[model samples]
Target: MSTPTGFMQYQRELPADRDPIERIKDWNEFHKHLSDEQLRTQGARCMDCGTPYCHTGMELAGSASGCPVNNLIPEWNNLIYRGLWREALDRLHKTNNFPEFTGRVCPAPCEGSCTVGLIGDPVTIKTIEHAIIERGFEEGWVVAQPPKVRTGKKVAVVGSGPAGLAAAAQLNKAGHKVTVYERADRLGGLLTYGIPTMKLEKNVVDRRVNLMREEGIEFVTNTEIGKDISRDELLKEFDAVIMCGGATKAREVEIEGRELNGIHLAMDYLNGTIKSYLDSNLEDGNYISAKDKDVIVIGGGDTGTDCVATALRHGCKSVTQFGTVGKAPLERDIINNPWPQFPNVYTLDYAQEEAKALYGEDPRAFSVLTKKFVGDANGNLKELHTVQIERTVDPETGRRIYKDIPGTEKVWPADLVFIAVGFEGPEKTLIDSFGLEQDRRTNVKAAYGKYKTNVDKVFAAGDMRRGQSLVVWAINEGREAAREVDKYLMGSSMLP
Candidate 1:
């Protein structure tokens, strides 16, 4: 630890983001940064609490309680506090392959369980992590250092998202010839399309990917596993296969008029906008437009907030987000949402914050259920019908129950609608082609610690196995699966 009384001396602080209203005009990253002294001050907030849980990497109440990659958070925080940027970067890189990714998009669960959070605000762990990696990059300390020896083993990682990238990085580090396959035109999966540019600039993704490429990882983009590359071919070519294809089967609602023209899936909308922006800077008419339209986003969480923000940038006339769950409490409920669990509280996410700045109120509408989509004469979207419901927990069963209130139905003027309900599991085409077994949730049935599938050398990890989850958890799974794959290839695995 840097100082015994550091936590008491420094209050938690983070860099202010670019002005929301101004940022919506373009697709540049909105994140600003703190000065070196300010960052060191924030790092000092990490106290010398006994048995630190910031790096515990466990689940509590079905939520991530700490850093999933088991980042040496405290060690690096003290290093940052001491103005040892290079040492801090080393500590960070020892665990996380891409700190830049987590530093930007990850909803840091480590801070929720920080010991200082029990009484006061938690340390700015996420921002500090971001700053350290950026500083390392700026100082020319971060560079590709390929493994000195090749294991003569080839590993194929499906998907280029957090998990796939992590697995590929680890396997490559273990001296395995790693090849990552992505169905998209670009290498990065969710990082490229699923997220908006305002949150994570694509250039940041390209920088890390280029570094990995320099490290000898082969990235095959726009190639589907089952279609372009067959299962038998992959088995014949690669020594082992790690499935990190992510849960792509979107969860959809069955309702009337759902097939209307303007109704679209959340991913489809996000993918199109980001891809188009990247390809032609939105000069070409390849993406969906929300301009001058009444937009309604169904569902909550980051995806829904992204829809709201995307719509705002599209200059939509108005935007609204509907959620099936009740609003979170303003403060953490110490009884149900106690220490160590990710805090379930009401706070405007970056996207929602931008939406609020433009719309004059929070764009989210909670505890509301979609009834049906009302279409016009030409079968285009007209309005959305919804019913307000009372969400309550059954005392004995501890199950959630939703009961619609009488006469609470309302019609929202929505020319366009985006469904962000969530995902069911990994898409079936590749799984079925590979003849992989699936669990009840439609997720690949691979053991958690042991990622091996029915096939001898074929493994599974990330959202494909765990269902829709945080990017950090996906990174954890990817790293672990790589270890298992490495062990299978060689007599033993030295990977952590």
Candidate 2:
């Protein structure tokens, strides 16, 4: 620890974000940075726990219990606390290939499992992490370091999302010639398109990609495997292949009036908006407009929250989100949700905070189920029919069920609807072309930590194999898959 009583001396604090209402007016990033002194104080809060669970990176109760990247949190925390910034950045980069991405987007599981959190608030690990990386960039310490020698082995990574990028970076570092294939015009598959611009600016992603390009990795855009490029061509060109294609197939909600004109998938809506915003600053009348519309976003996840924020930015009259489950408790239920499991407590995320600022209330309706969408004579969505629901358990099968409450049905006005109910699995196009086996959930059949598929010299990782997951988990899978690929290519591997 920086100091024995640092945790007790300094209470947890975070830099204030831009006012939500003011920030929604523009698409630029709204987060502000803390000064070096404040960040150092925050770093000092790391406790000297002999057994640090912050970086254990274990899964518990179907959620991540700690940092999935297994970041050396305490080490960097101590380094930053003692005013050793370059050293802190080095310690951070030793594990996470892209701290800039994770620091901005990751819902930090490291904070939940912090030993200090058991007593009081956890150290601002994420903030400190963000600070360290930004400092590295400002001081010009983050630069491309090309491999000293080439292994003469060539590897191909499909998709350019978190997993694909991490895998490509690692494989290149191991002296292998790496080529990444992205179907989209731009790189960073989900990172470039799925996430909104305000949350993760495109410049940050481009900065990293540009650096990677300088390190001798080849990136091919607008080229897809199995379609634009044949399966035989890939097998003939590379010694091994790693599928990092993310789970892009968005899940649909089957209900009445499904063919309404205004009903759209969340990813499509988000993807178009971002593309248009980047292309022509929304001047080109190419994307869907939410102006003067009453929007009802279906499904209450991060995507739904983002829909709400996007609508508000478009000058929508009103926006509301529907959730199938009941509201989470204000605090964790100690008996059910113990420490180390990501705390199931209630907190306002960035997008929700923006929604609440404009609407004067939380925009989410919990335990509400949409029965059908109502449309006009022109087949345009106008409203949605819904009913209140109650939770119950079946004694015989021990299965949880949702029971609708009587006399609680209502109609909500909705000029536009976005289905943000998550994803099923990776797209089957490339998977089928390779003739790879799939799990019952439609994910590529690859054992965790091993990443080897049934097909020879072909492996899978990230959302392609793990289904829909966090970016940090995708990074973990990508890094691990690179190690496995290295071992398979050579007699043994030294990759971590």
Candidate 3:
């Protein structure tokens, strides 16, 4: 029997965010948290669907759908509804180590598959997650709990990104001495540098890293394996090594003026800015500044969106986002992209919203592909030569193919260009040093459950193993890698 409300009984409501125009001026998080009362009502909106595909972690229609971490959504919602926040946090943390990061940045596939969303708006799962974890921190409930015993086994973890962090946390919890080596000067790879501060504050990352440190996870920064330390050295010092060095090598657009000086990879630009901010607050010359320049971002993924937002924060003259694929329709169930899954619909993200407020229209061009970069004599980029295109599915193979529409070429003004197409795979330095076999996509070759490399003691996880992926996927890989490591060390592991 139903405990409270049935279908269509509850109206959907979520917490409000800060003003778009006001938020773009600074890099602070724009989301405003809901009052405890407001949060409870939002939690009560979950109708407790029978199937509950929200947390099932399923793959539907050839794409990964639902939560990869398989979080206990309904349980936490009910707990939060009863004002049992501590219990709610515990339930939330049971599957996810860092809900705070996911809450802020995750695409919220859980909401996409929400049963309530089939007819009405989905529950505010992401906002509720943010509220629960923040409450945990505020009440002093989120404390450092070092393991009771150390397993005498030493593990070396490469790459200090989310996957590495999650693996270290779980492996350390299993009583193993875990040392995380980050090439960057600080911990939390992408979380610390790749993402812009407007979306996720560095303070949030620091707070969690500090807790992990107190919990006995040793963090070694500014150390690059194969350069600073050899693969053989890691083998001798640690019983096992886990490589979570994300897919950093971005996929480049091979055009006529690809080597132009002002054009740069999204990660390089974002990381430089983040590192500069961390060092001396804009005085540091390490990052690329998009201040007072016409910026063109290639690719319309999250990374491209971030570039637009960051450029706006840096006082860019103008910003435009280019997407090769056709523009998504405003509504779902349009036959182009269906529902009961991740609906491929056009909705303005935070960055797009800010751009529209400043420019009076969404600065996005669909079905447009860059043909060449027009650069001045000094090898500096000045503009982009692009053409509109159309994509059609092959009748025989059913695969979508893109073709440029002739006579639709145009030149767009640009002082800086950020390539956000995507990533190919991990770097080749460590892979060659370790002599690790790679897949067709150039990702580290390893079975799904068997994160082991060709080398006996070496392992891989996250983007390196699975290719460019989400933060949630990295966390899952880390947890799974830790479980495998525990089993390797003690002959069997109780860790889930």
Compose the digit string of candidate 2's lDDT tens values, residues 323-383: 9999999987879999988899888888788888988888889999999998999999989
Comparing candidate 1 with candidate 3, which one achieves the higher lDDT? Answer: 1
Q: Kindly state the number of residue pairs that clash in model 2.
A: 0
Per-residue accuracy of model 1 over 148-222 as CA lDDT, tens digit each = 999899999999999999999999999999999999999788888798898889999999999999999999998
Pairs that collide in candidate 1 are none
TM of each candidate vs. truth: 0.98, 0.99, 0.97
Ranking 1 against 2 by TM-score, winner: 2
Which structure is stronger by TM-score: 1 or 3? Answer: 1
Point out the higher-scoring one by lDDT: 2 or 3. 2
* Overall lDDT per candidate, in order of appearance: 0.91, 0.92, 0.89
The prediction achieving the highest TM-score against the true structure is 2
Off by over 4 Å in 1: 393-398
Error of 1 at 241 (Å): 0.8
The CA root-mean-square deviation of candidate 3, after full C-alpha superposition on the true structure, stands at 1.6
Model 2 regions more than 4 Å off: none
